[model samples]
Target: MSTTPVSEPMAIDSRSGSAAIIATEPAAQNSNHSCRDADLISKYDVSGPRYTSYPTALQFSETYTEATYRQQAQVNLKQGIAPVSLYVHVPFCQNICYYCACNKIVTADRSVARTYLDYLHKEISLQSELVGKYRPVTQLHLGGGTPTFFDGAELTELMHLLASHYNLSDSEQREYSIEIDPRTVTQDSLALLKGLGFNRLSLGVQDFDEQVQRAINRRQSVAMIKTLTETARLYQFKSVSYDLIYGLPLQTPASLAETLATVIDLSPDRIAFYNYAHLPQRFSSQRAIDRLDLPSAQQKIAMLALIAEQLTAAGYRHIGMDHFVKPQDELARAQQAGKLQRNFQGYSTSLAQDLVGLGVSSISSLHASYAQNERDLDAYYQRLDRGELPISKGVELTVDDQIRRQIIVQLICNLQLSIASIEKQFAIHFSEYFSQELLALQLIENDGLLSCEGDKVIIHERGRPMLRNICMCFDRYLPQGATASFSQTL
Candidate 1:
């Protein structure tokens, strides 16, 4: 129940009025540490989408009309090649956290949530019309501004609306999941979630240290989180994941290590150790944090190394960047078997063909294109009220976009890419078709970040920590001087 705020150093630029920039001293000038050079960071930290989708959401064009999205949905439904995965964004939080960068609005109005729910149901009906009849849903994820912000009745109503239209088969058990705020959940809430068929829960436990918690304006305790975990398990939650952050205000190696040790004791099936990307410009609430109270670059790197070492020692397998799982967890197994896939949601075990996103500001992906709903809440509701799909922008990927995406996904998910395999599958010679991208890889290889053996380009273990940098080689839409769109790759 401790609510004391933790103080930190001043390396983060809080007044930048843009994404908060955490300044890090360039690594020591040595051949082995060349990857940390200023030139390398400057070159790789360019503005590009995180590639959750092939044509990244930023690349989505205004030309994607409602008709286009409906047409695409019809074709995919007719093909019946893969089960659909649905993501619903609930963007209302009772209070704002200084460190939160997610697209959310702070409000205590229950009526707002209720009205949003009604519009969500309308959007669901709109989507159903496009796909026609029921298609078995394989996955359903409810994300942000605290999905539990709505009561159990609202959650059940939303799920029932989806199930009624999509038709979940008995044999096709859905991977129903939701993100829970530790400060918000109660016994009744947990019971309602279980009754509504939510089998997975992801709790946001940034840090257990009271000082750090206060610094970020997110106050919670180890005891409360432990109780929440126990409650979820008691309610038959199949998988529980905890989200942890590194390099936050008032964070130190010892403090973070102690937090991780305690988290391991809770024994959640998965952990996401995300780096604190201090972007105040993109998120105004972050402006409340003092920039002087952040960690140094060297400290940040050490903290990351420490987290990896401790998690690995605790028998958790590192599944690419920022995620770890127990050996029995499906994510780890998928990584080992090369079945891992990345989407708008960081990493996924389900191999659903298309992602249909509902709610304001959500994005969806299909075989040939990517589309995003309008980000403005009023705009989203207006479109739905007008009997529209709320689709504001999208991109139709070319054949080249598809091929490059395949290569990028393999590198990001598996840390290995075979040029010959890519060539054979796409019917294009890698060296000839992607000359510039290959040249970029050569620069990375020369720096010891990657290596080429025969026709395969493999990222070294050291390089694996910087997977985003490696993937930047193939991005076709990297804009010049657009450095503020994404968080740091470190």
Candidate 2:
């Protein structure tokens, strides 16, 4: 599984964010990292973090408290870290999916949502006091148990409350997105979201096969998705993304291929084809699934191959990791321009310096530290009721961590890092500061994952999927035997 760098630069499509159809190199040249190669995938299909954040969320601890969050929030605000990003978590879901791992509450009670919304508004106000009510919010994301679980009026009220406290961006360039359970969202609901300035929608459609859907306890028809897609398009939403999962119970190569085919027909602007990490020991909902019914490692690899082949054939450019998008999409543009970023919300085009997370189990990444809110619903409520921030844990980054973070981000986003730039920025010799890490990377380099060309380390095309493995060598706190806790790297 090795490759030589192409003599010409790999094709990066110039058509907005369109597919980078590399004509100079044979498709098979990158097969070892492609979704179509089973043997290649099986060999490196090991567990690893997604690297959404440097040091990763698993490193968070109780030592970082609410007071710590407040102090950092104040500092970031007073120092003018403007045009920040906000992630609002809605942890309530009407039903549970057997394979879900998110922090969520399952209930059919409307009262629960009402109470939660009230507290969420309160938390927003409290945070505004610390960070100021008028800081420009460049991006606002609603992620959840099912953000659409709220009625139209409730959602409108929530939006109004946020606008009252935060000086949200008025420019069309701002990204206002929300995750929706298509089953619960209606045409009217879609209109409401559009009217409220939510320009992007991420729909959860793990699989369309009836048997597979039943096995995961999430049964939604292809017709439902078609209707939703049509409505979203009719409303002229800026971007519509569909989320699909592989490795669920009863999922086979054939079933997954069919799923991919249907997803391609839907023609979403973006697709997130994720590998389902079945960790029943960690997520209680997973206990409902039959492990014996899950796909074998080889089968999972085959499924991955099929997904890559199908989506690539459908004209979606691989934007790294599980995300693929039309080249003209903003994400593709950012990737092409080397300004793409990864955060708790996954890949984003926003370059905001600070990201504030509100609601239970939400995590905030500030300029100097990472802070997470209380994971327990009762505890979060109690703290907020007492007029206190609900922060539970976080870590403050040191100079070394910051340097490694910048390097990892560069590699992950652009697949290249300039040693001279890093050395000049950090005021240290690159070889001297990361001698040990460079030594470790030699193994991957020998495998053709990357090459150190004097002052730069360029990740070859075949190495794109293994970005996590490459970045892990730089993590200071990656403990032995901890890899098993994370999902398999595809």
Candidate 3:
């Protein structure tokens, strides 16, 4: 890692003591002069899933039904397992960010949000009826298209409706989290959210540079973010996180470095430095961005290295794959204890029995299967109006799917896989069951990305930056020649 000189230390106020600050220098020029000779960018920039979930969302089929989902929920609940987590996806955003590929609907109709909330409540009740009343909810997350798009009262009602059915206790052990757009949040909104039991806030601060923000069509000033962070802290939010992206349009090394310098001064508990993936054909919004404004592959790589160096020097732990957290944050602690987990929400400290998702385009996971709600709002409401569950498509995991999912999750979350543990748990010889995957991993091992000792495969630190590439070796459903179907691994 490269080092940058700090002229002075800046102090940022925190609930605990002050946060340390360190200056960051502009990214050094890429040293890979031979990349052009071998066409390395084209070779390694193949389409791939981010592996947020094993068997990626693409594998979800139309064969599974609502009844199957209910059955699975009941069985899991009856096993007296730990409480499950809940994720509510509010898909409406007022404006479009060109770089975002998340499932979202851009609309300004407030009535649509209201109608959607009604259906969301019904779905919560349906799942509650199946899982029984006493099943405690250990974690609850409200994700976007800007979850804060709803007004204060609307948000409060949604929280109350879910809390009523799921029995959320006012305990610190339970993590209640939400995503917010800094441009949309208000002091009242933050207070309302805090009162409704949301203890964590993740502000979308993709790039502080004005030109970069304009290129992505997401314009929010650094002062706006600072005010929002200050207000969230005043409301006593347990943790504050910021999301930053490299490789976006108009993001030169100097501009991104300046943005990082400003961000470190704010001292969020967690930071996610993500890669901007441009897939115009799949995501129409991205087509609006001028490709010429974007950074090159080498520049993107340099920016990532710069972020790692600056953040590490400022006392943040690189908690694996695109996430950094202060040493005192629960995520960092969980990582140290080997209890960190990765879900659709990125890194988390919660280990719930399962995840129950509500609303259109939401996804749920039980031990036996994974189910998804209807993707279209019209279809979702029609199902609920007919007194039916809103699930349109899902996949019932076979015994093999379950075993493979466990292995993938372990590798992605913990960076280590034990073949013996998998065999003992699933009652199958690891080599016989995963012969093809092992062969693919061997190829990656030859490339110095991983090490295989006996039946165990460990991803080295060098491989950590390319964790997604390693995970793809085990993805069974990735269609052959699916070049334009997914995003870049970097």
Candidate 4:
């Protein structure tokens, strides 16, 4: 009875308040990092941090109080403000997907959204004031139970609120995106998002199989998504991405092959292929899913292979872990230039170093720390009412944390890490500083997961799925078996 460790969709996985899980390379030259390497993968397929940050969300602490967050923000403000990114969390959802692990609200009361947005506006003003009202916003994301849950007017108002408070970028190069639940949006909604200055759309298309949709309680027709993708293209939305998950109830590799067939037919500009993390205890909605119908770990591996092979064959580039993009996509080009990055939003171009997360449970990575707002709605509103930033917990990066972060981000984003470069930048001998991490890498290196040359460690294409396991060696905070608390890295 081999079980796959559960992994949350990177969408809200950061809980730090980024939106959308980003991911790719060109069509002409296939990296062939495809499904053929599943055998090697099964051996290293274990649970570990996604490494969206070096010290992941698990390291956030109450000791780093709201005051600490404010202090950091003020420090950065005085040191010379940097351009920033924004992630707004919309916690409402009209329905529940049994396998979902995001922080979301289930309600038919549309009025609740109006109330949430009102509080969010207050948060925007407070955060902008602290983070710097005139800082250029080079990137923006709207993540949620479903960002589209807000009516067109409400969505418009939300954008206006952000624009009025912060320096919103109207440049053609700014990466503005929002997550869309097909069930919650229409062509008008897409039009509205573009008019609001969002150039990207992330569609939640978990799996189109009728049986899979019923089991997960998220049903949307292929016709619906096709229409939206077409409309997004027609409207010239810079990029349209789809979110697809594997290892759900009743999913077979063959079924996913069919799903990919349809997915390829529609051909989204980018796709986030995630594994379904089935932890019933943590996410109550998952308790609604019966464990028996879930795919075996091995089956899930095969499904991973199927996705890689098919998408690559269709001329999509396998860029980072779980993301495939067409050759011409900006993300692919960014990866080639070693500028792709991962945050709460998963994979993205490194548009800005500081990000401000607004709304309850949204996480902000700024002021040399990662700060999270109150997790629940009540505490969020309570803090805002008191005229305070709703930040509840966070971690400031130490020199070691920053060093380790650079190493991890380089490997995950650029597919290779320059040991010499790291040593030079940090002014430390790599071998002496990470002596134990290097010794531990013996097993990983022998397994052909990566290679250690004079001053470089290269992650082989086939070894990409095992990235979490490799990175765990450098994690100071990850105790043995602590991975049980995280989603698996299949």
Q: Compose the digit string of candidate 2's lDDT tens values, residues 288-402.
A: 9999999988787667656766777777777755678886888877777767776666677775788888888877887778888888899999999898889888888889888
In candidate 1 the C-alpha lDDT for residue 78 amounts to 82
Note the residue pairs that clash in candidate 2. Answer: 17-327, 17-328, 18-327, 18-328, 35-305
Candidate 1, residues 1-490: lDDT per residue as tens digits?
1100000111121100000001111122122443345555455543333445555555667999887887788778786636777778898888878887676778988899899999999998888766643666777778866788888778888888888878654442467778888788886788888777778788888888999999999898888989989998888888888888888998999998899899889989888777676777766878988878888666676677777778877888777666788989887777777677766555776757787888887777765888888888999999988988899988888898988788888887777787887888989978899899889888888877778778888776556557777777787766453335666766
Q: What order do candidates take by TM-score, descending?
A: 4, 2, 1, 3
What does candidate 4's lDDT look like per residue over 1-490, in tens digits?
Answer: 0001111223224222111112222322334643345566666766677776667777788998988988888787974557888988888889888887787888999999989998998899888888888888988888876788899999999989998999999888888988888988889888888999999888888898999999999889999999999999999999988888889899999899999999999999988887786778777888999999999877887787778889988988887777888989887777777677776676777558887888888778875788888988999999999998898888999999999988887877777778878888899999999999998787888876677876777776666767777788888887744677777777
lDDT computed for candidate 3: 0.72
**In model 2, what is the error at residue 68, expressed in angstroms?**
1.3
Task: Write down the RMSD of all candidates, one decimal each.
Answer: 6.7, 6.5, 7.7, 4.2
Give the better candidate number (1 or 2) by lDDT.
Answer: 2
Using all chains and alpha carbons, the TM-scores for the candidates as numbered come to 0.89, 0.91, 0.89, 0.93
TM match of model 3 to true structure: 0.89
lDDT of model 4, residue 174: 89
lDDT of 3 by residue, 1-490 (tens): 0000000010000000000001111112322322232344455556676665556556677878887887787788676746777888888888988876666788988898888888888888888877655767877778766687788888989988987888786889878888888878788888988889999888888889998888888889888989989999998999888878888898988898899899899999888877777777666888998889889877776677778767877778776667778889987767666567766656777757577878777778776777888877899999999889887777787787778777777776667787888988899988888888899898878766578887678876545556767777776666565434566765
Runs in model 2 lying further than 4 Å from the true structure = 1-43
lDDT of each: 0.73, 0.76, 0.72, 0.79
Which model is ahead, 3 or 4, in terms of TM-score? 4
